[model samples]
Target: MPDYEPIVGRYLTIEVAGEACRIHVEEAGDGIPLVCLHTAGSDARQYRHLMCDPAITDHYRVIAFDMPWHGKSNPPVGWRDREYSLTTELYKDTIMAFCRAMELRHPVIMGCSMGGRVVLHLALEQADRFRAVIALEGADRLEPYYELDWLHRPDIHGGEVCAAIVSAQVAPQSPDEYRWETLWSYMQGGPGIFKGDLYFYWYDGHFDDRSPLIDTDKCPVYLLSGEYDSSCTPERTAATASRIAGAKATVMEGIGHFPMSENPALFRTYILPVLDEIRGAG
Candidate 1:
């Protein structure tokens, strides 16, 4: 018999912002819903390890989806008519729509990087809709570290440039195989998609003033940042956690921006306790 993984992949058609979008989703395990969001320029594949791990699946159903325009998810109709720029409203609406469409009642929502930042918004606006929120490598607002124009410039190879740029964000201690695997996802992103995602990451997702408003009593927020992540530094995550009452933040030693993808095994050490806490609370 051929070796097989328990994970399943499917496509779901949903409407967002008056346009139809076909989203690619992968899921595994069975129990409380654990909805995961991937990083900017990447897709649900980032959560492959989590979905496949029996330790987690035995207690939680892990569901990860590629936002339209990334991975196997196709962009909405007439995407060519306008530039693809992810805004705060669009990101939040897409997530909410997906949750409601799937009938995921009070699922535990977790996100990394761009996904990480949006969980803050979700906690602030839709706290009652989720049991808890987990953010990895997220911050209130990020200082622009790279030129967005370079990501989609006519002269640059978008794939190569993107992969190279994010390469440094991976920790040096991560296994070579997984580190390259993480970078490979960046290389495969559609032209301008990575840059478009950053539009929300760096500009539209500002929470410096808004994070303090999230009431942890209603919706708990747990933040984990990899020490090596220069983009969303550990300091920034701690500061954001500090502002939110009852929020918890921890720095994962020897990890980097793409914790789940770059080093899933190590990431597990930090995440398992959080999962246990959520399960205990539930």
Candidate 2:
């Protein structure tokens, strides 16, 4: 007999932004849906530990999907015709479409980094559709710390550059095995895809003007930032949370930007309480 994980992987074809996209999805456990969104240039693999944890799966269904052009998901038809740039509308629409397609009723959504920022957008625009939202390493705005253009330059190796830049964002305290695993995901991103994802991360996703408009009473918002995350600093996340009425913010010690992947053990110490709160609320 072979030891196997409880996680299940599958593909779903859904029409997003007028294009039929085949998305790679993985899920585990059972109960209220807990939809997870991965960081830019990475995939659902980031949440492997979360899905495998019986503590979480025992009370919640953990669902994660690789956005088109990332992970094992295939790009929409006619990829050569144009550049891929992620916009706020496109990101929100994709999530909405996926939830509808899956028939998830008021699922609790959680996202990290780029996915984190967008959850703010959802909390503002689509609050009625979700039971709650957890934003990890997220903020309303992030100043450009590195050259986005360098990510896709023909002269630079896209994977190497991306991996190198994110390497510093991982906390020094993180286990070497998990830290390298996080970087390996960056190295696997498709050409120009990392740059494209940053389009939203750096520019389109900022919610400085809109964040204050979020009605947390409609849907609860929880923002958590890793202490070592320089890109979306803990200060930034706390500031963003301050703008929204009733939003909560927390800082995970000894963790970094990619908490779920970079340091799962510590990340859980912070996340489990939030999950319990949501569960209790439900």
Q: Please list all clashing residue pairs in model 2, or write none if there are none.
A: none
Report the C-alpha lDDT of model 1 over 205-253, residue by residue, as the tens digit.
Answer: 8988999999999999999999999998988987888889899999999
lDDT on C-alpha atoms for all candidate structures = 0.94, 0.93
lDDT per residue for candidate 2 within 1-282, as digits (tens), equals 779899999999999999999999999999989999999988999999999999899999999999989999999999988898999999999999999989999999999999999999999899999999999998989998777889898999999999999898899999999999999999999998989999999999889789999898899999999999998898898789889889999988899999999999888889999999999987
State TM-scores per candidate: 0.99, 0.99
Model 1: per-residue Cα lDDT at residue 78: 82
Ten-residue region with minimum lDDT total, candidate 2: 144-153
For candidate 1, the per-residue lDDT at 65 reads 94
Q: How close is candidate 1 to the true structure, as a TM-score?
A: 0.99
Q: Relative to the unseen true structure, what is the C-alpha lDDT of residue 87 in candidate 1, on a scale of 0 to 100?
A: 97
